[model samples]
Target chain A: MELLEYGFMQRALLASLMVGLVAPAVGVFLVQRRLSLLGDGLGHVALTGVGVGVLTSSAPVGTALVAAVLGAVLIELVRARGRTSGDVALAVLFYGGIAGGVVLLSLAPRGQATNLDAYLFGAITTTTAADVAVFAVISGVVLAVVWLLGRRLYAVSDDEEYARAVGLPVLPLNIVLAALVASTVVLSMRVVGLLLISALMILPSAVAQLVGRSFRSTLYLACGVGVVVSVAGTAGSYYTGTPSGGTIVLLAIALFLVVTAGVALRDATARRRHGRQVEVHAAHPHEHGEGCGHRPVPHGDHVDYDHDGHLHAPHRTGTGTHYDEHDGSAHPPAAVVPPVGRERP
Target chain B: MTDPAIRLAGATIGYGDVAIVRDADLTVRRGEAVAVLGSNGSGKTTLSRGLLGLATVLGGTVEVLGAPVGRLRERGRVGYVPQRHTVSGAMPATVREVVGVGRLPRLGLFGRPGARDRAAVAEAVEAVGLADRLADPVAALSGGQQRRVLVARALAAEPELLVMDEPTAGVDAASQAALADVLARVSAAGTTLLVVTHETGPLAGVLTRAVVVDSGRLTYDGPLAGAGTAGPDCHHPDEAARPPVRGYRLDQPRPAPDAVRLRHGSR
Candidate 1:
């Protein structure tokens, strides 16, 4: 209650909440495109922006937003032009940004290099009301663009060639995605810090990929996960006197590990408990195996015989020689996958 | 004659200035199933890409469904099933979700897919025998099923001209049969087909006409039966084709009569 009473803490919560919503909304596409580390790369460029702001006495978040977006466009250009050296090129550019930042900040008049700590590790608990307003405005823009182009973005990110063939504007959508990521990184700079900001963007999407069955569901779940961890991590930091960026990232990774273990556990349990259409054919005098005249089909680790209408796979588990009946399809139904936790009926 | 589904005349197609398929001329009337046969790197794929407006058309007119490929406004009018390798992503997508991309051609970027779109998607999935797995992730399906999903995605557009590149490549025999059955049904439904392949394996039956691409030109364009036996003075045609699954593994793609390969090799 005391923490919420402070104006600074209230601003921090609002800022982090916006960051939570905007980050994963954009991050899901990045995850789908397998460009999850673009967020981290842009963060390094944002650090240079902060250094520029320090030397020029300008607004750090605004400058960082501009700088990060420019960095993203350049990265996309390199990635588009040369697929072979794109990663290596982006890596060099990202470090150059940080190196440029360190040089600029140290040269700032009456500014210590130590001042970069707040930008690097986040100063969420000390954010001003003005900072929260910027976060809200940028978060609003990012979320609106995502709402308008969510399907189009997914179509391009999921398969660039197919989207291009079908005539979706792949290049413009890619640039918009890069811009959204840059805006998200800068907006959350005060909440999660530029150094760890990408974790906030990507981790929730990673967790959602493991949790949700489809892209739409994954995007929704990513937003939910993002908000919960961002707000909770901020609150946790306020109460425990810990850093918000570290706390939020750790919480997210913990949730990802937990969801992963939970999914694996559910699948294993469902497969064993479901029995996979096991039936007792002991009364039948016919034994289906090699040289039995019936067609044999390989089914995963075992072989199934095409007898009658069902694929009869033999199993020996203390019940004599039994057969598992499968539908005519070559592969068994995915009932063992255990649909999303909410969809389980 | 009903307007041809595709017409390319004196078209020079390639990336940048390379000109892989040069000065090509071809035409296909609506409802005809034509197979474009050639080995890999024979510019067969480039010819199809030119038709789709993917590769650069440096000179001459290239048209699809009676309109220029670039100016064709109706995305749903021409369904494209690209090579199977280009259709997948690392992300998890459901059969319904993947097939839903086909509707984007009609729906555009902002248009919501209505009930009619949903019906089209469902019909496409049913046509491919994947209705039961509509909600399952495509990644969970076998490679054959994944290829079938790509076909369904293309079919969801309900295009008048369906262009498929290597539809049967890399698939198992059973899946090839299943795919052949789907293609047969699609062909019977009156959609124009242009399938590019190195060999017409199980697809030999669905495609009645064959256009052989070699040395940067359509060396042979005739009935599927004749293209294979275009032999030293050709052979007789079989139309009384009962078992249509007989394959036609024609010439492998090699150096063109022109300098396309030489230019490529120098680079």
Candidate 2:
């Protein structure tokens, strides 16, 4: 409560909370598209925007938003083209952006008040009331779009080809999603910093996937995680003289590890309980172990050996090590894909 | 009000510059259960994609349910189940959510799913026999069940012509039987069916006629029993004498993307 007595702290807190809410709300779709690095890419380009603002005596945030959106559009255009050289295009844009930013920032007048580190590593304490107002508008727009078109966006992100076949305006929705990411990147620039924006967007959503039962629940859980970490990380940064971005990301990663451990523990106990119900153990002359000439399949907390095209799990009883033949049905079909080279028909 | 479910005249379907299906000609009356058979590297899937307006229409005209593919405003009326669809294992989407997207086109972009939409989704899920697993994540489903989910997704659209590309591919027999059972119900309910598959297997009983696409041509079109004679590798020696299919390329004078968008704007 004492932190709110300061105008700057209140601004930082408000901005951080908006970034917290908006980052993961848009991020779930980005991660779904396998574009987790997009936030980072936009963050890199936003630096160029910052440099342009400083050199030309304009608002850094506005320039950053424009630049980030341009980068987003480029990424979307490449993606829509569906070519193999896309990675090269992305690398060029991101690297070229950073180099350009450094050059531009260096050219700024000698008496420029802003430090590059503030943008790179988030000086949450330096947030102005005006910046907070802008953050409020951007975050409000992002959240409204997500609310209105949640299912449509999910459909397009989850399965683009299917969505298009079903007539969902795949290209337009893609552009909208790109714009959302761009706005989100700029919105998050001050709280989590440009470099660490993706972490804020991705990490919470990643953790939510581990425990969420459905898409809606996962989205809600991701937003909840986002808020908890942002607010706590902001408060924690105030207490300790640490960068807000690092503190928030570290807290997010710690939460990720903790939730991962809990899920693994729960799965292990469930597997054990399930194991107790089954009594049959396959008798085989060749015992399966490390370096066994069999395909190792990951089966939740334990590795299942693919024995003669069948999955085998090693069971340890009071007797000794025995390989229990797990049903072939347990394996994902992608693992046992029928012969390759067959045309899609 | 009355048009064949599908009508293709010398259509050559392909992607980009390469043509896969060449000079395909076929027509199916309303309510007909037709299976398009072909082998690997054959143009069957490409032909399917071309007719669905997903791929480039290299040549000729394709009409589905009385309208051109892209001009068909109600895209939900043409349900499609893609081949070996994994349903995006990267994210956590429940069966309901996955199937729910199938209704989006019919519901319009801005409109939310109403009770009727929800009922349609539930009905579609139940049709595929995944009613109990509606709330469960699609990632947890086995490959066979995922295939069923894809079918349910298409069925949710309530399309007049339900085209399923290789539904039995990579699927176990039990699931194929389940799929066939659902198709039987859908067919009985008067929705046309266009199935593309390498292995007919359990679906053989459901298909009344077979149209085999070999080397991008309709080698045979008749009863299901004769499909094996003109199997994927079976190409006639005189096929070379046939005229080439007219092709349209990007460099060619094709309709611009903006024009296409303008047409789709009303949709």
Candidate 3:
């Protein structure tokens, strides 16, 4: 209640909420495509934009958005040409942007022009009401785009080659994806800064993926993680006098580690229980190559290999399919239709 | 009669200026189960990609379902099963979720899947005999099962034309038979099937015709029985001692990498 009374604190919280919610939606797509580092690369490019805006006395957000979008298009073009691998092109762009940013910042006049440290690590509590409005607008656009293209994006990220074969406009979709990612990275600078923006984008999805069962569930859970971490980390930073962005990212990493450990423990226990069940059921444990010489033991649609030499009944698992381990034969024959009567026969 | 389900005449498929398969002419009538057989880098996959608009049609015309390959927009009418290895390694999607994606083109950019999409997904999973494992994560499935999931995803689209690349490449013998069974049902349903595989194996039972590609050229296009095994022109021609047809083993140790680099284009 006390923190909410202050105008700056209210603005910071809203900014945190906006970035926290949108980043993971974009992050899930990136993670599924195994391009998680693209966020980080784009963040570096945004740094150059910030530098240019600082030197020109223009709004940093607009400059950063433009630069990042241009950088993303360049990256996509390089990838399309196939001359160099994607990572190689991204690396070149990332380092070049950062280097250009550093050179520009060093050349600018020192006092009151721009606080480079603020853009690097963020100053969440310093966000003004105008910044909150911008965050809201940007977040609104990101969410709408994602909502409309979510399924198609999932298909592309799941398998680009297949999506293309299905005639899903892979290149344009990819470009749109890059543009959205660029927008999110630019908007998130207020919450987590350029350096730590990718933390917001990637960590929640990684954690949610470890525990969530399905894609939709993983996406919702990731948003939940992002929101929870942002609130707790922002409040903790206020109380502890720490940098808000760094604290939030650290909290995310901690949550990720905790979830990972919990998943590992749960898997271990399940493995132990499974082992016990196998031991109880084993009259004979057939090794990989040591075929049972008998029919497969069907256990409710699953073929269980028993340690006992007793031959298991050859019951149909589904649609009269049975497997004999000795010769690797499946019943009902592999073909669905009657065998084609070849003219030669 | 309706036009062929797919036709590519004098099509040169490649990435840029370099053509992989030169002047490949292929046609598949409705209700036919055809396999485009070739060794690795022999341009069989490229040919399929060309038909699906994945590859650049350097020359000649490529059409699908009475539409140009590049302009055809009815995605639900054509289903594709890419190599299984690319489908599962990255995402954490479940078998049901992945299969549900098959319904996306039908759903459009903003459309949602209602009862019809769900039913299609269920039917596909059942057809592949993976109904019990619908909720299982795709990563948890074995390589063979993963391949089946890909097939189910394509089937969920209810496509009239199904194109699959190496459906049984790394699958075990039993799973291969099961896949064959599923493909048979798809073919029996009157869907045109284009299966690209190196060895006929279990598919030999159902494939009505075989179109062989050697060095980016159509070597044979005839009934499955008449198409002889991989010969001197097939992959690894250096290993002439290797038996052709049923004896060709995909799991065999690789020859030199350069030996299979006949096509210098997108995979």
The prediction achieving the highest DockQ against the true structure is: 3
Ranking by TM-score: 3, 2, 1
What range of 10 consecutive residues in model 3 chain B has the weakest lDDT sum?
B251-260
How do the residues B1-267 of candidate 2 rate in per-residue lDDT, one tens digit apiece?
Answer: 478889888766666655666667888998989888865545677777776778777667778888777763746688989876467646688899999988998977789999999999999999887787788777766677788889999998998988888888777665788888999999999999999877776898898888887666788899887776543523343234343334533122232111111121121
Can you tell me which runs of candidate 1 are displaced by over 4 Å?
A82-85, A111-114, A268-345, B1-3, B72-76, B85-87, B230-267
Model 1 chain B, poorest ten-residue lDDT window? B232-241
Give per-residue CA lDDT, model 1, range B23-114, as digits (tens).
78898988999988765455787888788767777777888877788763744477888786424665567889999988887886689889
lDDT of each: 0.79, 0.80, 0.77
lDDT of 2 at B30: 86
Clashing pairs in 1: B215-B256
Number of colliding residue pairs in model 2? 0
Q: Can you tell me which runs of candidate 2 are displaced by over 4 Å? A: A280-345, B72-74, B233-267
RMSD in Å for all candidates: 6.9, 8.9, 8.1
Candidate 1 has a TM-score of 0.83
CA lDDT, candidate 3, residue A163 = 82
Candidate 3 regions with alpha-carbon error over 4 angstroms: A83-86, A107-111, A277-345, B72-76, B229-238, B241-267
Query: Between 2 and 3, whose TM-score is larger?
Result: 3
Instruction: Report residue A95 deviation for candidate 2 (angstroms).
Output: 1.9
C-alpha displacement of B41 in model 1, angstroms? 2.9
